[model samples]
Target: MGQHESNTKLIWQVFGFLSIVTIVEVILGIIKPHGLHFTNFLGTSLLNWIFIILTLVKAAGIMWYFMHMNHERKNFVNSIILPLIILIPYLVTLLLIEGHYIHEVMGSYINWKY
Candidate 1:
């Protein structure tokens, strides 16, 4: 196949996959089944997991195809993604830990006041 034809095919493939994923996400949101309502993981809810996964998939599609990061130099890709990879986890952990501390303090103070 010619270069233009190959690129067109790849673009179509990505669009098709994203469309299917988007449809599924929408269906899941509308369904919102009972079992999925309260499912929890690592202090995060299952509905939260669904939203996070969908957002990450969208982010990956934008970064890889829309932004053309997949075709960029390896060093450039790493330069942009590495800090996000590192910082996101660090920030999440910091926020969760601080939230727990606040929860504990509030629980104790409320108990003492009553």
Candidate 2:
């Protein structure tokens, strides 16, 4: 059927997009650009923030197409997404703060002659 063909095409398109994003992530991880590594944002390197953001984007894309969330009502989608939107950043911020604190405390011991 024509509808089936179109759906198949759309699926392939989404698959290609997802693959490209994944490839980019892999390349970035392998290269580990020094600028990204050295530049700090939110108490962590820019590279880490980029990885986290790209991961979230991939997750959203997977949910949208594979999980059929795009077909759901706006209200329903918002209900499901809103809590995650609120929670993910909150958790990441807490993680960064705690991690920075721990690193700071530990760094002081590195140069001390025991």
Which candidate number maximizes lDDT? 2
Q: Write model 2 residue lDDT over 1-114, tens digit each, in one string.
A: 664445778789889988998998999998999999789887888989999998899999999999999999999999999999999999999999998888789987777331
Q: Per-residue error at 105 for model 1, in Å?
A: 13
In model 2, state the lDDT of residue 35: 95
Residue 36 CA error for candidate 2 (Å)? Answer: 0.8
Candidate with maximal TM-score: 2
Worst 10 residues of 1 by lDDT: 105-114
